[model samples]
Target: MAISSYDISSANTELARRAGYVDAQWALPAINAVELRRLQRRSNLHATLSTSLWLGLTVIAGFAVVATAWSWWSIPSVAVYAALYGGASDSRWHEMGHGTAFRSRRANDVIYYLACFMLLRGPTIWRWSHYRHHTDTIIKGHDAEIAFQRPPSVARTLWRFTHLQGGSELLLRLVRHAGGRLDDEAKELVPAHERRRVVLESRIMIGVLLIAVIATVVLRSAIPVVLIGGSTFLGGWLVVFFGITQHAGLQENVFDHRLNTRTVMMNPVFRFLYLNMNFHVEHHMFPSVPYYSLPSLHGEISSQLAPALPSTWAAYRQIIGAFRRQQVDPNYEIPLELPKIEGDARPVEIGAESWMRGPSGEVIVGLETSFGLGELRKVDIGRHSVVVGRTESGSLFACEGWCTHAKVHLGEGAVIGEEIECPKHNARFDCRTGEATRKPAKDGLTTYPVTVSKGRVSVHLVGIDSVGS
Candidate 1:
C-alpha cells in the first residue's frame, strides 16, 4: 500500500519539488511597493484594544458560566465562553504568529503563547509550520496546514465542527512532543536546532493541562477542566466555521491565491470575531499585510484579483458543491477564472532598468517621483544586492538587501520609526545607519551613503574600499 500523499515525507513531496511547487515563488497582484508598505503598517493600539475586548468578554463569559453552573443557563454561558476562548483565540494565534499583530515583539509573543495553549498548538512548532504553509499553500505533500485534504472526507470535515477529533489530535501531539519525540512531519518542518524548544514548550503545556485535570479532580467537579481545557473544543466550531471557507474545495498546488483561496464579504460582527480573515485570498497573497489592514488591501488590489464572495452563506454553498464532487473525484478542482498575468508578480524588483548611473559616479536606485516614503525595493547589481528605502521624513537610505539575522529580504519587511523590521522574526535594524537595533539580530547591516538628487534616488558606495577597511 502506498503511504498517504499528505505525509510530508511521501514520494509526492519529491514530485511537488520536481514540479516546482515546493517553496516556489507565487504570483502576486499588482500592488506596488509603496501601497503595500502602507497596508503592512502595524498598530500597537489596535492590537491592544482588540485583545482587551476579546479577553474582557471571555472573562465575563467565564464568570457567567461559573455563576450558573449546572443550570440551564450554563449551556448558553459555556457556549459563549467557548467561542470567546477557543474560537477567537484561533485568529489571535494566527495573526500574532505572523508578528503583524503587535508593533512590539514581546506583545506578539505573549499573546501567541497564550493562544497556542488555548489551541493546543506548540508555539515554536506551529510558527515554522505556518511559515511552510505560506511558502507552499495547499501544495500536496508540502503544506501541513491544508485543512481539507483531497478525496475530501465529508465525515471528517463535518466532524471538525465539533472540534473533538481535531482538538484531540492536537492534544495527542502535545503529549507525544512532551515525551521528547518528534514526528516525521515535525522533523521535516522545524529546524534541528529548534526541536529542543518544541520539547520544552510541549512539556510546559502538558504540565498546565495536568494541573487543570488535577484541579477538576480535587474540586469533585468538571468546572475546572471545563473552564480551562474544555473550552478549546467547545469554541472550536467557530474556528472551523471561519477556517473552512478559506481554501476548501479550491484549486491547490497553484501559484495564484486567486485560484486556491476564497475571500468573503462579512458583516461587522463576523469581521470582528475573525479579524478580517474573510479577506482570505488577500491575506495569503500578501502575508506581510496585517489583519486590520486586509480590507484596505482587498480594496487596493481587488481589480487585479478574484471578486470576494458575496457572503459566508454563498461561500459555503459553493464549497459544498465542490466537496460532493471531490468525494468521488479525487482529482476534482473547483474551476477558477484566473486573471491574465503579464509581468513577473513576485515582490523582488531587479534588472538594469531598476537602476542607472548618476553624474557624480553614484548608482541611481529608483526615481524620487515613484519611490514613496516607507517604500522598500530590492535592486541588484551583478552579485551584490541592496535594499533602497525612503524613510517617513523623506530621507533616503540604502543597506545590504537581507536581514542580518536571517536571509529574509529586507524589502519584504516593514518600516517603523526609522527601523526596518524583519517579517519572520520581528528583528529590528536602524534603516538609516544600518545598526542592529533589536534582538535576534546582533550583527549590523552595512549602510550606504544615499542621497536624492534631480528626481533620482542614488546611493554612493562610500565604503566601496575604505568605510570598513
Candidate 2:
C-alpha cells in the first residue's frame, strides 16, 4: 500500500511542494489600514489581567484541592484545577506562542513557557512546529498539526478525550528531543538553528519532570507528581474538547483559510477558556491580531467569511458527519458554501504601479492616505525591494522588503509600535532605524529616507539605474 499523504516524508510531500502548496500565499479579505491597525494593537495590560485571572483561579482551585484532600470534595476541586491547568493552558500557550498576548516580550515568554509545561509541550520545539502549522495549515504531508488525518480514525479521536495516549506521546517526544534525538520529520520541520534550543528546552522540561518524580518517590505519595506531571493527563480532556472543534473535517491543502477553517459562536465561558479562539478562521487569516481584538476583527471582515456556526454543538454535528463519510470515501470534504468575495483582494500596494519621480531627489511613493498609518508596501525600485510602512503613530519609514532572518516579505507583517513584526516568525525590526529589535531576526534591515509633504509621501532612492521585476 502507498504511504499516507499525511506522512511528512511521503512522496505527497514533494508533490505538494512542487505544486506550490508549501508556503503558498493564503488569500485574505481586504480591510483598510486604519481599522486593521486598531485591531492589531497589542496591550500588556490586557494580557496581564487575563493571565492574572486565570492564574488566580488556578491557585484557588489548587488550594481547594489541598483543603479537601482525601475527601470526595477533592474530586470537584481537582477537576477545576485540571480544567484550568490542562485545559485552558492550551489556548494560553497558543496566544503567547504567537507573541500576540502581550506587548512585553518578557511577559509573553513567561506565559508561553508556563503554558507549554502545563500541557507537556516542549517550548522551543512546539514554537517552530506552530510556525509550520500556520505556514502550511492543513496541507497534508507538510503541516505537522493536522488534527484529524485522512481516513479519519474515530477511535483515536475518542481516545484523545482521555488524553492518556495523547499526553504520553507528548511526554515521550519531550524525552527523545531532550536526548538530542529528532525523527526525520521533526528534523525537516524544525530549522537547524532552532534544534539546539529545542534540545535545551527539552532537557529543561525533562529535568522538571524528574524532580516531580523524585518528589513522588521521596514523599511516598502521588501528590507531587499529581500536582505537576499528572495535571497534563487529568486536564487534557478540556484541551481535546475545545481543540477538536477547530479545523476538524474542514477542507485541507487550501490557500484560503475561510475555506479550511471555521468560526463558531461559543458561550462566554468557552470563549474565555479558549481565549476567543473560536474565531478560528479570523485567527488563522489575520494572525497578527491579538486575542482581545478578535471579536472586532470578525466584525471588520465577517462578510467575506463563511457564516459563523450557530454554536459549537452545530459544528460538532457537521464534523462528525464529515468524519463518518470520510471514513468510507477518504476524499470527502464538508461542503462549505462560502460567500463569493468580489475582487478577492488583499490589502497591499504594488510597488511598480504606485511609485513615480518626485520634484526633489526623492521618489513619490504615494499620497499620505496611500501609505496610511500601520501600512507596509513592498516597493521594487531598481535593484532594491524596499518595504515602506507608516507606523501607528502616523510616521512613515522605509526598509528592506524581506526579513533578514527569513526571506518573507515584511509588507505582509504588522507594524507593532515602533517595531515591525515578521508575519512568519514574529521577528521584530525597528521601523525607524531598521535595527533587528528581536530574534529570529538577527540582521538589521537597510533603511531609506522617507518624506511626507502636502499630503504626498515620497522616498529617497539609493543608486537607482534600472527598474525591473
Candidate 3:
C-alpha cells in the first residue's frame, strides 16, 4: 500500500484506511498480572511531593528574579524563572492532563488547569486533542500534534526556540477562541459540548494576561508582565529542546511506537523538569503508567523496544541526521533495532473467536466452566468484540471489548471491583451500567445482558437499553 500523504484531510480516507492506519489495533509485549498491578498502582504521596517540588522551585526562581531585577544577575535569574514558569509547565501540563500524576482526580485537575494557562493552551481543547494524539499517534492527517512534519522545516524548527512563530500562532488562536471562534480542526477534535468550556478557558487565560499587563502599566515597570505572560516566549526553548526528541525525526503512519517514537536518557535535573518524559516511547506505549513508575516500566519493556539512546545528546545526534536525510528524502526513517522476543512478531489477537447461539436465541459466549472467576475473555459476536468476565461471585458481565478512550482491547486490562480499567490509559468503566468512571474515557461501553444457564454463558443480543431486562 502507498503511504498516506500524512495530513488531517487524509484521516479516515481510502488511502489511510487501506494502509491499516485508521483505528488500527496495536500489539503489546506480554506482561504478567503481578507486574501490571505494580505498574498501575497510583500514590497520592508521590504525586504530592513531585508537584510540591515543582511549585517550590518556581516560587524560589520568581523571588530570585524580583530581588535582582536591575542587576546583571537578573538575566540568569529570569532565565531560571522563565524555564520554571513556562518550560517546565509543559511537562506538568502533560502529566496532569493524563490524570495519571495524582491518585486524586481533583489534584490532577488543579495542576492541569494551572499548567494549561501557563502554557497558553485551552484545557478542554488540549485534552481532546491529546486524546486524538494518542489514538492516531504519528499518523499523518489524523494526529493534531505531529511536530516537525515530514520534509522537516529547518527554519521553522529553529524559530520555535524563540517561541516566535509557534507561540504567536497559539496566542492568536487563543484570541480567536476567546471570541467564541474555533478553527475547523478545533471544532472537529473538540466535542460540541466541550467547545463552550474551551471558549471560557480562553477568556480566563486572556483575562489573566490582561491583568498582568494592567499591573505593569500601573507600576510603571515590566516586571509583572515579564514574570507572568511574557515568560512563555523567553523560556519556551526548554519545551522545544525536550519536545523535539519525541518523534521529531521518526516515521509517521506506523502503528508501533518503537518505530516512530524515541526514548532518551537525561540528567536528574532535566528529568525533574521534564517529569521523566525522556522515556517517550514507554510513555506512549503505556500512558496510564504514572511518571514516577515509568523507569520501572522501561526496565520491563526496554528489550522489546528499539535500544534507547543513552543520553539526550545521543538522541539529538540521531535526530539531526534524520532531519538532514528527510529534508531531501521524506520517506527516510531511522531503523529501530528491536530485540527478539518469543511470540513478539505475531499480530494482536482481535476478533479471534466467533460466538455461537444458545438454546433460547442467546449468543453463546463460552462455556461457564471454562471462564474462571475474575478472568476476562474476549468473544466476537458478529462484528463486535465483547469482553466477558466473571466476577468474584461468579456473576457474568459483558461490555464492548475495545476501550472507549483509545480502542484498546479491554480483555487485556485489569479488573478492579465492578470496573474494568483500559490497559492503554487506565480509563475505567462500570461493568454493569457501562458508565465511564474515569478521565479520558468520557464515553461508556456498549453493554450486553449476560446469563449463565446449563453450564454455558450467553449474552443477550438486544440493544443496550434492553440489557438485563
- Top of the candidates by lDDT: 2
- Candidate 1 TM-score over all chains jointly: 0.88
Q: lDDT tens digits, residues 332-353, model 1?
A: 9889776655465645332223
Candidate 2 lDDT by residue in tens digits, 186-224: 787677877888888889999999999999899887767
Model 3 over residues 136-255: C-alpha lDDT tens digits?
798877787887788887887898889977778888899999999998778877878778888888999999999999999999988898899788878889999999999988878777
Model 3 C-alpha lDDT versus the unseen true structure: 0.81
The reply for model 3, stretches above 4 Å from the true place, is: 1-7, 10-15, 345-400, 414-419, 446-469
RMSD of every candidate to native, in Å, equals 3.9, 2.7, 4.5
Per-model TM values vs. the true structure: 0.88, 0.92, 0.84
Candidate 3, after superposition: displacement of residue 461 in Å? 10
**How well does model 1 score by local distance difference test?**
0.83
Descending-TM-score candidate ranking: 2, 1, 3
Sorted by lDDT, highest first, which candidate order results?
A: 2, 1, 3
Q: Score residue 437 of candidate 1 by CA lDDT.
A: 80
